[model samples]
Target: MAAKRRRPAGKGAGAIGCAPFFVLIVVALIIQYWWVLLIAVGVVALTVALVRSTSGPARPAKVPPPPRPQPVVAPPRAVPTGEDLTAQLRAHKRISRVRDMQEWDYEWIRLAHPGKSVREVNDIANTHFARGRSIGINWGDPSAP
Candidate 1:
């Protein structure tokens, strides 16, 4: 004869039976300890509020510091002024005049004797320079005049 199936004895009814009782106990405890639950919730809310407040606004990934100011200093030389400034300007003008005269002399020589090479121009000017010196007059270079 085949053995008839027997149900597992205690497992079925006991676990199912305990669920409502457990739920009823938890509901009773919650009613009695309501203030504790409130306090726990308040603590969690306070922690979240503090964390958010302390975090503040989002910041840039990297911030470069402002550059340091450099000390402004006068140049290491004295500023030319008064007679010194005048002399400096006058010397520059005289040098410029000498350059102008030399340029004019070359142009004049080139025009006066067309087809003369530069070497011939130098020779002509040198030959004429000593002639006017005896008369206390400068020649070749019109710079002195």
Candidate 2:
């Protein structure tokens, strides 16, 4: 003959037993005193509300546009005036009594042959200018000033 066996409690049976115990404990706590549980729940709820309000989500920072380019400054002499300065220039030319000269009349020489010193070139230019010659000056290399 086989031995008889007893069945284990099921999921619903455990929950049903727990339900009665939970109700009895709650009733006992309510009968003993109710304010302690109420105050504890209130405090927990207030703490949760405070945390949510204070530090829940943050927004991204706004970035500004790059600085605009500053306006360029012109030389004081180049600034145009409301009046016409051409008449003044013409009057100044008349007073100076300068004669128009051509490129061929002036000597087409560079300080000396190639690779002259800066002092020698300056002296040559000064000499020619003093003689009233229209100098056709050029740098050896186009890239030079």
lDDT top scorer: 1
Give the runs in model 2 whose Cα sits over 4 Å from its true position.
2-22, 55-57, 61-145
Q: Against the hidden reference, what TM-scores do the models get?
A: 0.36, 0.26
Candidate 2: C-alpha lDDT: 0.61
Candidate 2 root-mean-square deviation in Å: 13.9
Cα TM-score of candidate 1: 0.36
How big is the RMSD of model 1? 13.4
lDDT of 1 by residue, 1-145 (tens): 9999998776676657668989999999999999999999999999999998896678878978989999998889988999999999999998787667666765676688888888998887666544432122265434677
Question: Candidate 2: lDDT of 26?
Answer: 86
Model 1 ranges with Cα > 4 A deviation: 1-75, 126-145
Record all residue pairs in model 1 with backbone atoms less than 3 Å apart, i.e. clashing: none
RMSD of each: 13.4, 13.9
Alpha carbon lDDT of each predicted model: 0.76, 0.61
